[model samples]
Target: MSLKITFSLTASLAVLLSCAAKKNQQAEADCPPKPCTMEFRTVGVVFTDSKGDTLQVKDFSVTLKATGKKLPSGAEQSTDAANPFYMIASDGDKSALSVEGDTVVVSGTHPSSGQVKKTDFVISGGRCECHINKVSGPEKIVF
Candidate 1:
């Protein structure tokens, strides 16, 4: 290509990349300071036995990533890692949430399934997290 044509193409490419980078940075800017930490109580879990009976336990803990999100009201919310499907609430409950460890433990009620206790609580999948806004996954239920 001619020198002038080559220069024009290079400049155009640079601008396109810059624009794309800016857009990406803007999207991530909603995150609270890097490595932001928060705690959430009330994470739901399911432990079942072979007899179709849920395992009764005093506490349950699991690790998960938490990220920050921008609410429609211009507010900020914490989500599980890079996915917004799992939200971390501010209201501190019995649920023990650890950002550093990326783990959470929920306790209080004895383990029981909807069919076993006539309640609508069951964890069919191995493990999953769901947002409290009612964005529950087909494999998991986030109460």
Candidate 2:
């Protein structure tokens, strides 16, 4: 009698799992295809002094405000004086985002003054979204 009960429970569990798998498949099928561009998508910030001269912000980093998680920086370490662009986030970094998303702080230091400046950004994008966006904050910051 005990053996029969165990077998019945196992069969019922299998059936439930099968139904769930089918439901998941249907949900995936219902989702529309998200077309993405081949170009590498990235959010960058250009910093400048009050005089409108490009200021090189060194050691740029991103931090999630909610969890205090530090996102990786993809900025190159080259000393190209002409390019002071700071990377905020790239498409590949979408795995770190949650469905509801979170606010992030992009901080960096001025090369000459050593003054640290921070900018707040609301980033929301997942792997399905195709690209990350800077919901707020200026494209060019004058420090």
Candidate 3:
């Protein structure tokens, strides 16, 4: 009788372990291995005047507020005349950018007016979000 009881307990333990392993495997399968998007993504700030004219900004720079590390600028779309602006960050940067809340400063000089404008931005991105997200920032800056 004792032997039968021990066998039953052992079988139960094995079943439980098998179930737990299956559950873990399912959880791992639920998430895609490469969930991030391959398409190029970027966050840009557009500069405009009070007249609503799209103004080109010069001497544009993007810097991380905490470390004061300047990030690389994204490629400009020369063919995109409709939307001329400065890129703050891009997913192409990979590890350089993090998904965690990061404060970024974007500054540029108005070509004609020679006026410099600085904008604070909270941007985030990484494997999960894939594309960068602009948490807080003016999409268009009116001079």
Candidate 4:
């Protein structure tokens, strides 16, 4: 009877050990270790006005902003200035942009008339599009 009891106790211990080993293995497989060096990035913004005419950097001055849950108010991120720049807007697209929360504010002197223009645009994805329209004599972007 004593021998039989000892055998039963050993079997129970073996089962417990097996379960613990499997649990440890599963935990390791779930998430791997990172090198600890990584960076966050945003997407570039392309601009246009109500006329659907392409804007160059020379046409305007642009300031890009990036914000997350931490800073809902938003903060300045980067400024792109290139030749043929529509004042400072863009001839094409901008890169090195973060994919996280980002907003772009544009205000620049009209390349031709030197009139100042101000507007804000929130870029969501690959298509961070902006369209300016004159409503009640105030230029605004619709969506």
Ranking by TM-score: 2, 3, 4, 1
Q: lDDT of all predictions, in order shown?
A: 0.33, 0.76, 0.76, 0.41
Which residue ranges in model 2 land beyond 4 Å of their true spot?
Answer: 1-32, 73-79
RMSD of 1: 15.0
TM-score to native of every candidate shown: 0.25, 0.68, 0.66, 0.27
In model 4, where do residues sit more than 4 Å from their true spots?
1-59, 65-100, 125-143
**lDDT (0-100) at residue 46 of candidate 2?**
85
The alpha-carbon deviation from the true structure for residue 107 of candidate 4, after best TM-score superposition, in angstroms, is 2.9
Q: Sort the predicted structures by lDDT, highest score first.
A: 3, 2, 4, 1
Clashes of 1: 2
Predicted candidate 3 versus true structure: per-residue lDDT over 84-116, tens digit per residue: 867788875544567786888888788798999
In candidate 2, clashing pairs total 0
Best by TM-score: 2
Model 2 over residues 43-134: C-alpha lDDT tens digits? 77888898989887877777888888886644433367796677777776776765456688878888899888888888776645666776
TM-score of model 2 vs. true structure: 0.68
- Measured on C-alpha atoms, candidate 1 has an lDDT of 0.33
TM-score of 3: 0.66
